[model samples]
Target chain A: MKITNVKSYLVEDIVKPFTWQVDRPGSGDGRDPRKNFSCVMVLDTDEGISGYAKGPKGRIMMDLVERRFSSDLIGMNPLNSEKIWEKCWDTDRLEEYPLYAMAMVDIAVWDIKGKKAGLPVYKLLGGYRDEIPAYASTTSYDTLEEYRDVVEASLSAGYPSIKLHLRYRDVKTNAKLCEKVREWVGDDFSLTLDASGLWNYTDSLWFGRVLEELKFEWYEEPMREFELESYKKLCDKLDIPILAAECSDGSHWNAAEFIRRDACDIMRTSTHYKGGFTGGMKVGHVAEAFGMKAEVHGGGHNNLHLCLALPNNTYYEDLVIDVEDIEAKGQGQLKFENGMYSFKEQVAGVGIEYDHDELETISIQKYEKF
Target chain B: MKITNVKSYLVEDIVKPFTWQVDRPGSGDGRDPRKNFSCVMVLDTDEGISGYAKGPKGRIMMDLVERRFSSDLIGMNPLNSEKIWEKCWDTDRLEEYPLYAMAMVDIAVWDIKGKKAGLPVYKLLGGYRDEIPAYASTTSYDTLEEYRDVVEASLSAGYPSIKLHLRYRDVKTNAKLCEKVREWVGDDFSLTLDASGLWNYTDSLWFGRVLEELKFEWYEEPMREFELESYKKLCDKLDIPILAAECSDGSHWNAAEFIRRDACDIMRTSTHYKGGFTGGMKVGHVAEAFGMKAEVHGGGHNNLHLCLALPNNTYYEDLVIDVEDIEAKGQGQLKFENGMYSFKEQVAGVGIEYDHDELETISIQKYEKF
Candidate 1:
């Protein structure tokens, strides 16, 4: 079916106000927390089926889709997602499109295909499983006590594993925090650390040693993603798996380099940052070919679909900003139970239904193109 | 239809033997000329329609397809070229597949889809033009006089452009040869040079300045493909368009980096090196988006198809090893006439038919996997 229209709505205050770790003090690149705005995109086809997806919180994504991508997308076959994706990605040579913008379009196109085929997107992607265990991926907390409380609460909430997005404190302070967490959670629990690409080679080496001693599952992006040589050195020196290239550009192509260089033991992929399902699957399959795990980086319906579809992916990252915000507003239709995430079996498209009426009420701005 | 079988035949002495430029003296990193053999690949479907393509002149590609890729490909829908391309590329994470092996399978798959749809492969790729002007891309000769003779012969054969692949002599010698050729062809003859990546940054700069003064069309691969910083500097220092990354890995993703960094003025793409048709299209579209020409490298039916399909590509490279060997065996059914390359209209699949009888007679090795 030909896509006839593209629409986006900017809904303000849709998500709860939460502090992202990158915005906290001592974080090397301090940035403000994401605003509570959510951008929802919809693709309308001539055949009466419509596709839906959520974008990052801003008008920029909406504006980009409407102004840059929408014209080329109009009158194109929705089932030709591969061609459409190439078209969008082609814009990168000049526009250098933010991964999120392309992701939104790609996810929506997959949604359209799923709806047309009358199957969930995961099934269309060659489904691997219906359910997947999740890890409680935390944001930075202000104090050691606060971290402890969140970890305890996540365990109480039935998460089987936890990944700390610790504040960029001194290595010693972070090591102490890790020690206390291990002491609190015991040795058998699955634990990992994401330093958010905040450490240099030496600091990463030292912190990695601490993680290895603590028996942490994987060390996530301790050094910057561009530091391939440092990563190679780190992987060689430490037994701990280095999970890297989370926010890196070039998708599976770049991940292949990391794999070829033996730079990272685990490859990071998600619909949000990895050019949507097509790109995520490419990375996941590449990692699988290398006998490595490709972890889903964030919690969302799209990421859940990816987790269910990718045979090599380990866990669905249930990003926890606040203990109280665990079952937060933007969780969509995905079902989370006993540390596992599942979705409706035969629900077509992305399986997330939006209340258009509610969105109309909350939308701060709207754009339409044909 | 499902691909029920994959078959490869290594036919010995299938083409005329000619001296390859890379094998000649003074050519840096000298290698032997390709043995006069051709690898013919066929993908048989349950529906009784088969797809055909040619690979490099070796059993390695045949072995790769039969041993590693065939089993995974057997049950797959031949029409799902995108997914299949991903599967083949995924193997590269571990196997590090030569681009030709993957290109063979991809080309065959596209052939199947085109045959099924009753169109040429170029039409399947959204045909841009039925014909593209050809440039006689020469192999390196021993002397400047030989180069002049080949250039004159190519012009006499109706070629509008000539790209000189000169031996790696000193800069002064090469500059004098380029000047002599430019003087002979005059200002408007569309002359270019391919250094085959033998120079360092300083020499590239010097030669590039001479080329700019001579009003050459483009300077190709003056420095190695991996030297992105040097390419950036060269592009900044010279007026001549630099066509880099002809043999680089990572396909369009790496090409995108070169474009983003302004490392090259022209991009290079061909089905033989750039993944396959899907990849060639990606790089071509990327170059088009950036308002740059993506010159199609090498010659053959598949590259001709790419030159036809890609809107941004300037010319089909009719690689001339020996003038008498131009229409020799293995040229397939593509028609070259009066400085242009054209394929049969509405000829289903890749539009090139292979004679199975001739192949069986010359067969040195054969493989089949189902």
Candidate 2:
């Protein structure tokens, strides 16, 4: 019942090199596909129910838990998720910050809770639906033809929707690309655009109008998340649902300001950024109270289960290269069948099993604290 | 020039037991005289001009540096104060948070800068003033007479001003105590009230009115710092200046929102909370651009020098005990005379020299990472 120890493993190249048809807008600018790494955290408890979670980029988060958070967690009951989350916030007193570290521990604690209860994390959380619709969250691409091909392939593979991480720089060119994707997918398929907070107010407005014309489902992170006045203006001027507050300052309390200001249509909450699942749940509740949908920022089994628990969230953004490619690489990646993703029935907690052999091979460093 | 190793020394009871006439407003309710602990950090560079700082609440922060931050610092240049501060921010991506840990290192970096330049830290920070007026920041008292006596004693001691950390509950009693102190201190003597964020909207309004009637200098932390709407209302309605945004979510950018909302008259920025001297300086600059005064929350030679470097800051709230009491315990405390405190000519960097014997006696934990 007590958290006895916490271990962090830094795994490198766990993910195979996968290229986006379009370059990731405004980052690395023509460099090779940036490699992927995992910081895996395993929480060991006295009662023999170990919890697991993925930490932030390697040694940083692992060191955070061991040095700063371990003492607080060591003697406490693993079920006290709320207290553990609050302790992480109080440790720094920075408005529920150090969220990356908090999430690693919190997700693990939740994993413990699910395991102890003999229920999936989703069932423990309110389990609104057994399955949620999956949308293909596409990476950026170079040409319109590439985007068109990807969308066509995704639709052909039975994905109900696609969300684009569009190109940076030119608003007109990005708008043209969105139009091409919309035309390629046709009217029945849902499409959304994530510009990665690339545009300013005027450009965001210009591009938003284009999405509105094409009946795109939503336009996400069009402007800086903190630009409340601009977000309000964009929300007023545009017809597309604005998904924002993804990387809010600290806790959900910080994100609530966006809702308070009437800034965006859909609120973005995640275990990674908004403290952890505890923080994410609070954000979802806050958005729900305002009659707004709180969208999980990206896809993962953890996020999908959280979506299932919260009635307010509507879709799962299944992130990938191609389903076959991910499955081929094996171990860490989830298997996608026609875009629907779920945890195995026997898999409790976060439910995603680590490929231990692959994890060990890629691991560059490891730290354990009790 | 490169940081070779980082050492954290956890010193216990370095601060002597000094009781306030009353308790601190809302914290440590009814506990015995609180023990003082120091988390001292020493940044050893390859070139041998080392830097030092005191971190947040004992071993917690010291361990943070040893376990998480040392690796990042080992090969880093001590002169890259700005870059070092940013890297700390990037470590968590929590809005330049974990300020407590960052401050401990940054103060040392600034110290290094001052030593390397053979100029005091203030001179490096733009040296707006060689000396700053020190105000007696009083702890809570049990009775109005105790407060009246303390104010009278502080004034008689040649202090220019006194700020009160008033009782936790009962707005009316706190207002009455404020009125009594104001009447006793008479006109032209500055008095500020720190309610310790003990009041809500109505009570804050009620007590703020009393301070206004008495011509108090400022009201500090009347309500929760995050209550932007309440702060805006309080600022608009009250004649006395509202000092707030002390522990904002992410560095000063989070605090800047208070200015953007026109929420408070004076801004609170400190090395401990606003990342470090680097972040504190940024907050000070932001407040300066708005034509508002940014006040350092507490006194320390480190903070005083930071204040001296920033033009917008006006005074230092010398915290906890009388300067004499502070100096009596030894090492890090500054000397105060005739309402002013300044660094000694020989004191370089942060200008604080540890009482090595006292530090050694109190040392309970030590961590070093290279």
Candidate 3:
């Protein structure tokens, strides 16, 4: 199939609120409204099928690809998504770069291609499964009440487990939150503590000790993502497994070195940011070879498509998008039943259905590629 | 100081085509056009001031930043350019991020800010230089004829000295390029060589022996930018100093650490891809603090803003953008004279004026900022 149009919609309503340790938090040094937003790209094919890619940071990346690399895909056989991804990536074309945007778009396009071909996204990725387990990850919170509500909400919403966003607050608040949540959920449920790099070794250690007393599943990002030596040291100091790195740059070398050095126990396998499904798949292969936990980092629908089809990844991060919050539509949004989610067996893309109204609301703009 | 608008222009033309070895020259990858192109970004402020930024893989990085960050700067205070850069970077709201795009935008904004404030960009960074010196970096072929022509061009153009881009050719080529040019200039001329990660341990040792014959100033990037131990070994084995970096990620700590450990002689600086100006300034500061050569890498009108302002950066690279390549207004463009160039005195904002036609050609169709 030949690709026809690559269009971007800037959703006015779906905003992802900022929760960065984004400049030491509350410093007034941070302000990005886009932090609370989503930008979607729809790539239409001449065969009457379309691909939808949800770029983490909006219209720019997808929009640019539409303008620049459009010709690379347009009129070319659309089934060769992986080959096309490689072409876009290998085209360094700059003295230095952000090749990742091209990557995210490529995968999204692949998802669409798979659907059009009447196959699953992961099947094209060498399908390792028909479904995968999931963990509901709370996006953000400001108080204990917020944490409790999210925790209790995730449980009732049928997540096999729950992950917390811990940062910028007092150590006592974290210690207390973990202890209280564990008491509320009991030892039978899986509980994970994600600090998201807001802590130093001392902070991670303090929380690690308390989480141990409460028997938390793992401590995510005890230190910064690349603090390999510290991560290794902390792994030795605490009995709990440390899961990290959704934002580490460098290469698989960064992750490989961490594992080779015994720095982490549970590994976060990410597409787009790290490497796309191909990169993430390779990371999964490495983690499994090393016997590390491989979980999908949050907010990647393209990844969840592959995750559901992979076995090495038993835990998928469920970014409970308030779907109703925005008019986003797709035919492949995965379904959750009794804390378990699976592909719909349509073999047509990810199977998340699309909403036409949501699609109509986003701003459509053209970027110059030639 | 209010940035009423953030106008971004994608510059696809190469002032001078750059050549570098990729896929080892004879590899089948040579047929790839993606490997052959270069892109640059010019950020113009609403107040008739402009800052030029070279992106990470120029076009891609430029697109990513312009897509996500441009809208933010539309009504922002240009005075807080650095602060804005940190926000986009720290939060990382976008996907495929090393987020170098944000950094590129940040740098150009600062240059624009400096020009608007009637100071050199580096002066806004604290008046580190009243005037700076430069090195003539020739990108001509290694063949004797081309080398002779370019060196003569550089000399007639009146640079205090020159640096050779060495690789795939030989010591003989460098000798021919430098010694002949030196002899032609009659002895007082200085020279350096960029091995461009071409020489290894033994190769460096061999080059060291041969280099003394010509009395080259320092060998640049004699090995890979990160090969600290090898560099240390090479440095110990040679009498001549070694210059390293320029082609690097901002977080090449191992390289900096190696320099900290006395691995090489100079710290080569580049503002294009890493963190744009802010990141370059950080690296420059690190080099200054460590008493290493803050040799400015890459050449351009934008670079002129950097080179003329940093005292610690005694030498600027010659990445030329001919007057014909520049579409900006006025006689503010640079011209080589007496082996030196002067920063315009008391001129406000990045000094270069934009061509209204070029501006209209790349103007935004629409923009809104919070």
Q: Say which candidate scores most in TM-score.
A: 2
lDDT of 2 by residue, A27-122 (tens): 211112344445788778888888888853454555465555666677888899998886676554422335666788788899999989988888
B-chain TM-scores per prediction: 0.93, 0.90, 0.77
Which pairs clash inside model 2?
A21-A141, A22-A140, A22-A141, A22-A142, B22-B140, B22-B141
lDDT of 3 by residue, A1-370 (tens): 7777666665534345445332343211123444333456666778888776655444445445544455556665567766766556444332222435655566666767677768877777777766666787765555667667667767766678887766455788778777888877878899887776676788788888898888888888866564566777899899998887556643354566567657788877777655466667766777878877677776445667657655667787775423231122123455556666665455566555556566775455433222
Query: What lDDT score goes with residue B29 in model 3?
Result: 21
In order, what is each prediction's RMSD in angstroms? 23.0, 6.6, 6.9
Better of 2 and 3 by DockQ: 3
> Candidate 1, residues A284-337: lDDT per residue as tens digits?
999999999999889778998999999999899987877686655235567778
Best by DockQ: 3
Taking all chains together, the TM-score of candidate 2 against the true structure is: 0.74
* DockQ of all candidate complexes: 0.01, 0.14, 0.16
Q: Tell me how many clashing residue pairs each candidate has.
A: 0, 6, 34
Compared with the true structure, the alpha-carbon lDDT of candidate 2 equals 0.72
Q: What share of the true interface contacts does candidate 1 keep?
A: 0.00
lDDT of 3 at A278: 64
Compute the interface RMSD for each candidate structure: 20.5, 8.5, 7.2
